[model samples]
Target chain A: MNEALTLLSFGEHGWGDTIAIGALVTVSLALASLPFGLALGFLLALAKKSAEPSLKLAANIYTTIFRGLPELLTLFLVYFGVQIGFQKALKLIGIETYFEVNSFVAGMFALSFVFSSYASEAFLSAFRGIPQGQFEGGQALGLSRKQTMTFIILPQLVRLALPALGNLWLILLKETALVSTIGLADLMREAGIAARVTKEAFLFFGVACLIYLILAIISSTGLARLERWSKRGDTAR
Target chain B: MTVVSSDTALPPPPPLPRRWTKARILGHVLMALWIVSGASLLFYLVTNINSPFVQKYWPDYVDGFLVTLQIVSVSLLIGALLSLPIAAARASRWKVLSAPAYAYVYFFRGTPLLAQTFLVYYGAGGFRTELEAIGLWTFFREAWYCVIFTFSLNTSAYQAEILRGAILNVPKGQWEGAAALGLSQPVTFFKVILPQALMVALRPYGNEIILMIKGSAIASIVTVFDLMGETRRAYSRTYDFQAYIWAAVIYLMMVETLRRVWDRLEMRLTRHLKR
Candidate 1:
């Protein structure tokens, strides 16, 4: 029908523009959270490998608790939980302006926190696979511990971690859809509004699905290439 | 990056020159900061536990908790049951049997579950008048059915993958032995292959179930009065956003209990494999 076409058309009445922007937001947020997640994961891995018993226990608890909990619940805790914590802190400073946490920032932090827990384990496993002899060689050359970790251990770890890190990125990309519940103007949220407004729920939702599928396919292809590149040496035999 | 030789069975690195001196200090400092933050949050949560609003709304909170468990458990059971056949289908050598199941898994796994839920709930909602004309409107009319359907399908995709991986991990020699015994294909699958695959699949399936339990929170968006639904209601009405913290605690406890159950199941399944 004409109505369905109009509903889906890229014209002013259509949601084609809104949905495109929403998809971009989702991708950006996922990318923005990646480095943050990687840094946190690296620290957690380090903590777990630390000699201090307390530090190791804390790291274990962090990963266990976050990985075990649901992503939605974790989002609630981070979004609302962080707001409550910040407000309480503000109360101490005697400054209250009804300032609210930005949904995008809160959403990114929540996701990165969850992503880090999984990433740390992957990174740790990969780091462990690196020959300790490399570190020993670096140490014998009068290299500082930090230099050894950076120059010797990390390069090998990156090679091993690439495939896993790519997979985590894929998961993170999909997980970003959950943020729509908190009123972020991501693809899902935008589609939800358009569906409600036009009452052509199928039209808007189908578009959303297509957008997500496109994003997923593109990212997956890139990830597959990275995975293949990482495994190039193994294929020679 | 260089690929080291397999013969290089390297010894552990010597103690870092300064040992754990700076690193340990920095580690302690960083660890202490995180622990303090976590402890403070716990303290805040506990102190607010006795608020009058908590006492008044305790029943609603409990209702939400129960609803969460109900949705999660049902969807997981339904999903698991559905996935077993789909997984078997995926493992089938026949292209006719495998292709459709493979596509199903790919589509579901390729997209976010949240999008799938919306497409089903809202997209299906658009066909309401037509659906009502048929006998199936009764099922589609209820939010519960929509939530359960969406979740079951999503989890089925994941479960199928897990099952496929587990099936692949089964040794080829076992299948040969089953053939040597002159067992029929179905008998081999049910008796020999399934038993082994089930052992490997159980732990991952347990994790999936727990994930579903937590995922049920999303069902609230579609008017399902699950735990997250109830928590949202409590927060909006009383302006006590801290109610989410309580919900989080309940979810944490559920996950912890599931972890213990998963550990036990893993131990039980692998007992024979243990040296």
Candidate 2:
């Protein structure tokens, strides 16, 4: 017991601090990607709904390609392919500056790209679910198109989209672990390093799994509360 | 009044002038640029495939594809079998039977599969002594078995939930009718409920298969020479970025094919309900 405690203790020799920091990195990665993904998803949903054939096709292709590919492959493409492509493009444009696509950035790009595809689907369905009368009613009340969207449409869309978005959030949190494959010092990577160093793979990995479960449980509870809050108006109706 | 009608006829609506709006023009330009970039990227990939390195490594990728198929099929078969009892337990009236099953599903679904894989693969090393004593050390030590073990367990949780949902989705009327016929509980479930529940489950089962195909890519990290593993190997040897693209294409093909087949299967299974 004493030895195990020493192994997990935070100090110059122990990995407790490192693993904690890794957990923080994991959280930040998820948070950083969430808004970017949501914005892209909103845009994609709009594009898909647009009258223009080209715009709709573009959005369709984007979602299909991203959604069809595995997340790890996407990460590799961004981490290696995009970095090289960017540098090459810069050179052609007479720029001598060097740019590196770090694992965190690559992971963020890949995950957000994946998240946006699914989110767009969720948003599209939610948009379809809104009653046509709501829009007509807003117009009948003399509300402009923009006003109708903001006051009448967006709120209801949020309520409709919340559950699917919550599921995506949970998935995004889990996907942060994939960044470890690209050498990001996220929770899994930190656990791996510690395990290798201490020759205690079971203990470190067990700890890592526990940390992930705790995070998952906390997020799920929060999501449930959010769901209830979003649906509060339903009970009154 | 009749003479005034011709002159007041709105002048043929001025031919509905074809003025371009700023937003319309911008949308068109953005769409064109997107298409151009996408086409050029594909063009580059197609033209670059003539490399000698790609030719030499093509066989390795084919072998890796087979390995990936093998892993996914085996694990899914085992997972489907294991999910049956667990799903039963999850839906049982007895709390003693249900709680542990619920916990298993919750934990496995809540956390990432990668973490679970690591725990099983690396963590099993700690149990080398006990595993050896049970004559299972050889299986536990190999990365292949570790991946299969982890994947089967992980997928069982998901499959169990799918099964439970399908079972619950059966109409209450069906159960009542079965009971009215004086059928035994097990008989009602097996004869009446199970077939209909299975029909409902077909789509989700197909979805699970697709997810497993994608998830199995993680096995490459554990040194399983799956498709992704071979991609990494090829990339290291030739420094060819296109190697990853090739693997992605293959995965995309497999997923798309599976999706279409699954859709057809669902339609066939549920055809009676359709008009």
Candidate 3:
């Protein structure tokens, strides 16, 4: 027990600093991708809700492909595939320097795609929850299509989507661990290194699990509060 | 008189035309990003299908597919079996039984499966001495076995909750009806209640299986050569984006097939419930 404490202690000889940095990286990765994911997903919902068969088909195909594929598989594809694509394009342009995709950038890109695909479904459901009369109401009030979307539908859509989006955010947080496979110094990777160096595999991994559990707990509480706040103006239950 | 005259004059405007103008114009306006990316991706896929990619990596992918199928199926079977008792425990009135069951579910549901897998795979080394003493080291030592063990435990938590929910969804009248008819509790549960409960569980079970199929890709990180594993290997050798793309295609096909099959099964099972 004493030895375990020493190993995890925040000192030059301990791994506490490394693990703390990793936890920060994991949170930042999830944070950076959230806006991109939410925006893309809203667009997807719009596309699905549209009248054009071709546009709807495109949106359907995008969600099907991303949602079906494994998160790790998507990560590797984006990480390696982007680098390869860049290298080829650079070759074509005669800028012979080898190109690379940063692990953080690649991780964010892949997570955003996966998050958006899932979020699209949630957003679509939120759209369905709105009545047809609401759109007609917007029109009767002389609002343009865009104005109807922005001023009328958008606020309620955000409220309806909050729960599903919160769930997706948790999934995204867990998925950030996959970036560790590609050498992003996330919580999982740091734990892995600490385990290897100290030969205390159980201790570090257990610590990592605890950290994740705590984050999940906090997010659940935060989401509950946010949901309550969103419902403040809503009609009596 | 005008309303009736117009209603008679206009052969009910086709449902399509009314929605086409407004929504289509919005769709076109919102699809600027789609126009560029969608066209490029379609072009890339069309141009690359015949590029000697499948020919080279098809065998490896096939092997990986079989492995993937084996692990997922085996773990799911084991998980379903294990969930029965846990579900019972969770549904029990006793705190002794229910508390631990709830903890199991909470831990597995809250934490990432990747962390759980690593905990079992590498963390097994921490217990090397104790395991060897108990003649269980061999089981924990192999990545394949560790993965199966972790996945089974992880999925069992999810399955248990589903089972508990399904069983609870059966009305109180089910129990009372069985008692009034002089049927045994176990008999009533097995014969009268479970069938109805299964109907409730069917869709969630399908979703769970789909999740397992996707989650199984992490087995590759532990040196298990599942489909994603083979894709990584192929990509390492060729550095071709096509390798990962092919893997994605195969996975999507699997998911789509299962989705169709499950829908059919759900329809068949619930035919009596519908008109």
Candidate 4:
């Protein structure tokens, strides 16, 4: 009991600070990927809406491939895969340097890429949910297609896309833990390390879960507020 | 814009009008990231072909992939079997039986899979002495057993919801008709309700099976030599990160195959509904 308490303590020797930083890094990674993922998702939604066979097929294959694979598998692919590219480029430049791909970058790239595939499906449905008549109205106003898409089509799509996007983000946040497999000292990894050293897996894991739950609660609240804000624009219609 | 407007007036775009426009070319260029990422992974493994890393660990990755496939297939089979009874209980009229089943589904679904996996695995470890006293430690001690136990329980909750939703989607008239024929409650469920519900449920179950294939990789943490486990081992021994890339390639191929099967199944199931 004493040993467990000391291990969990916030002293210089204790891992409390390290674990806290890990939690911070996890949050930062999720936030950084959010906008990029949204953009990727929007493109995917557009591609899915394509009338052409090959374009539609391409979008279908993209979502199907990413959605079917495991998050950790994707992470491993991105982690080492990027390293291979860097090494090849270095060789081409006649530099023998071994370029290290850091864990933070790897985690960010992998999570965002995977999150976009799911988000694309969400956004595509949201786009489909809008009545065809609204677009007709946009055209009736003499607005160009691009203007109609930007001003009329997208804002409403965002509103419709919010709930599913929120759920995807929640799943994405929890999945950041997989980054630890590549030696990233994220919240789960830190907790695992502490658990290993002390052999008190329960205590550290409990703390890790508590942190994740708190993160989930906070993000859900923020999303609720955003949803409310998006709804305000619906009143203009 | 003119083409789009004309096409809109005609109801649906023309069959094939040079699908790859410049905008689409740009879109494809951007999405080249995924293909590039996948290609980079392949390059990593191939370049490291003659490295000691590949020589020592290539067999391990193959063995690990087999184990992962085995674990995922078994868990999906068992989990789907178990979920039927639980779904029935939840959908049943008895509050005593239904409430507990509902709570179990809710709790498991609400939490992340990783936490639940650890809770079951480590929690079992914590209670080993007590379990031994009760003569259950033998079963709990094996890594494979623990992995199966955790995965089966985890998937059962998700599958219960899928089944319950499908079952409820069955028309109430089926029950009335069954009763008009003097069928028993069990007979109505098994014969009438289940068959219809299964058509709805099977597609989602396929989705769940694909998900389980992914989730089984988590078992690597518990010393189970799944594909991910082998990758981790190779990286640790050789410090050649490409080993992990090979594992990921294998996983991607397996998942892509499952996705094709799922798409076909969904297409067949919904064919009658389509125009």
Candidate 5:
């Protein structure tokens, strides 16, 4: 027990620092991708709902391809295939520098792409749930398209989208663990290293699992509160 | 705007011609370009199907597919069986029976399956002495057993939650109806509640199975020669990007086919509920 404690101690000889940094990396990776994903998802939803058949088709194909693929395969394709393609393109353009995608960037890009595909579906359904009369009402009040979107549609869309988005966030958090496979020094990777160095796989992995559970529990509670807060206006109605 | 005005205007102006805006024209052009590029890429891959590298590595992918199927099937079967008792425990009114069940589900669901896999696979090595004493060391030492164990445990938690939810979804009137019919508790539950709960749980169970199929790809990272593992190996050998593409296509086909079959099954099972 003392040996295990020492192994986990926050000292130069211990892995506490590495594991902490790994956890931070995992959180940051998820955070960095969230906005990109949500924005793209919003765009995709709009494209899907647009009157233009071409735009709708494009959005359908995009979501289908991304959603159909596994997350790890997507990561690998982006990391390896894109890197190779990009380097070749650069070479053709007479750029000699070797450009490679770091694991974090690859993970962020792949995960965001996957997240957007799923989130687009959520956003589309939420958009569909809005009454047509609400849009007509906005128009009757002389609201510009932008104003109607921002002031009228978005607020309600958000309330509808929040629960699904929260669930997506949870999935995203867990997915950060997959980044470890691509050699990212995230919490899972750090635990792996600690396990290898100390031959204490049980201890380190157990610690990692506990950390993930803590994050999940905290986030779940926060999400529950957010859901309640979002519905407060509804309760009054 | 024009349509509204036309209702008040003379003769409705021939229903106004369909006008394509600049954005619409641009969208059409871009969509055409996208389809052309996608088709060309597919054509390139098809033409290269007979390439020597692909010919050599194709069998590896097939083997990997078989291994993946085997692992997923066995683990799912074991997981479904294991989930029933856990679900029963979770649904129990007694705290003593439910608390540990709740903890199991919570811990398993909260953490990533990768962590659980590592804890089982690598962690078992750390307890070789204790395992050997209990004659379980040989099982832990093998990656196959470890993967099966971890996958089963991880999936059982999700399955138990689905089952418990289904059990609760069986209406209270069901219990009353059973009691009024002079049925014992066990007979009522097995005959009435279980069937209804199972019906309600079918869609979620299908979703869980789909998730497990995707989740099983992680087993490749642990050196199991699953489809993803073969894809990785093929990529390393030939530096061909199509290897990953092939694996992705296979996975896509599996998921899509499973979803369709599940939907059909759900429709058939719940047909009685529909008017």
Candidate 6:
């Protein structure tokens, strides 16, 4: 027990600080991807619901491919495939310079792709939950379409979409661990280093799991509270 | 009955006005840009055959594909079996039975599969001597076995939840009707309720199976030569992007095929319910 404590201590001999930084990376990755992902997801939802058949079909195909593919594969594709493609494009444009995509950027791009695909589904359902009359009512107010979306529809959409999106956030938090494979010093990777060096694989891995569990618990409770707050206006309509 | 049809039929409802909505305009611009840029991407991938990449790694990719299939299928089979009792316990009236079941599900569902896998695979090393003494080291020592073990446990939780929900949704009347018929509880569950519950679970089961297929890629990380593992080897050898793209194509095809097959299976199973 004392050995375990000393091994995890924050000093030169200990690995606590490294693991703490990893946890921060994990949280930051998830947080940083949120706005971009949400924006893309909203656009995807719009495309899927659009009157244009081709647009809808394209959106469907995009979501299907993104969601069905493994996150690991997606990460690798962004890491390797995008780099190669980008280089080739640059070459074609008459510029030649050796470049590499950062692992963090690749991870973010892949996570956003996956996140948006799932989020689009939630957004689509939320859009459905609103009555058509809501849109018509917006028009009745002589509000421009964009104005109506910003002032009226979006607030309601956020409420209806909150539970599903909140669940996705939990999924995303865990998914950040995948970035560790690409060499991001995330929680999993830090523990991995600690385990390898100390030969206490169980202790370190167990600690990692505990940290993830705590984060998941905290997120769930926060989301539950947010759900209630979002539904404050909801009643026996 | 209406002889004035041709002349009086309200002047073919004045052709609806083209709104030229902002969204439509944006969609058009996006379409044009994609047609120029994204279309080229699709064209290149579909037509540009990297023969050397394919010829060199095709066999390896095939082997990896089989391994992936074997992992997903074997683990899912075991997971389904494990989930049966778990689902029962979760549905049980006894707090003792249900509470542990709930905790098991929550822990597995809460954490990432990769970490659970690391815990099982490397954590086994921490207990090498104990495992060896118990004659279980041989099993735990194999990366393949560890992966299957972790996957089975992870998937079992999801399967259990699906089953518990399905069983609960079987309706109060079925249980009452079975009891009124003098059918014992176990017999009723086995003969009547289970079949109905299974039908309700069919779609979710299909989804779980697809998820397992996608997830099996992680098995490669532990040195199991699964599809992703094979792709990684190919990319390392050539530094070619086509290897990963091809793997993605294969995965997409597998998922699409299963989706269609599942749809057909669902329709066939529920044929009686159709009008």
lDDT of 5 at A77: 87
The clash tally of candidate 4 reads: 0
Better of 1 and 5 by DockQ: 5
Segments of candidate 6 deviating more than 4 angstroms: A90-97, A235-237, B1-50
| Model 4 agreement with the true structure over B1-275: per-residue lDDT tens digits | 44556545766666775656776786566567667876876686677788887787878878998999889888878888889788878988999999999877755655567766666666576677899999999988888898898799889988999989998999999999999999999999899998888888878888788888888888987899999888888877776667665776688789778878888987888787689
| TM match of model 2 to true structure | 0.92
Q: Which has the higher DockQ value, candidate number 4 or candidate number 6?
A: 6
| Interface RMSD of every predicted model, in angstroms | 2.1, 1.7, 2.4, 3.1, 1.7, 1.7
Off by over 4 Å in 3: A234-237, B1-56
* Candidate 5 C-alpha lDDT tens digits along B4-50: 57567666356776579755785688699888988987897798799
Comparing to the true complex, what docking class would candidate 2 get? Answer: medium
TM-score of each: 0.91, 0.92, 0.91, 0.83, 0.93, 0.93
Q: Which residues of candidate 2, in runs, are more than 4 Å off?
A: A93-99, B1-34
Per-residue error for A118 in candidate 3, Å, reads 0.8
Candidate 4 Cα errors over 4 Å, as ranges? A1-20, A52-54, A217-237, B1-21, B27-59, B89-103, B235-242, B266-275
Cα lDDT tens digits for candidate 1, A70-130: 7887887788777887888898999885657788998899899999999999988897887
User: Which tens-of-lDDT digit does each residue in B185-263 have in candidate 1?
Assistant: 8999889998899898888888788778867878888888888888888888886877777777777888888889889
Point out where model 5 deviates above 4 Å: A94-97, B1-18, B21-30
Root mean square deviation (Cα) for candidate 6: 2.5
DockQ of each candidate, alpha-carbon based? 0.50, 0.62, 0.58, 0.32, 0.64, 0.65
- Evaluated at residue B89, the lDDT of candidate 3 is 94
Model 3 Cα shift for residue A42 (angstroms) = 1.3
Per-residue lDDT over B139-160 for candidate 2, one digit per residue giving the tens place of the 0 to 100 score: 9999999999999999999999
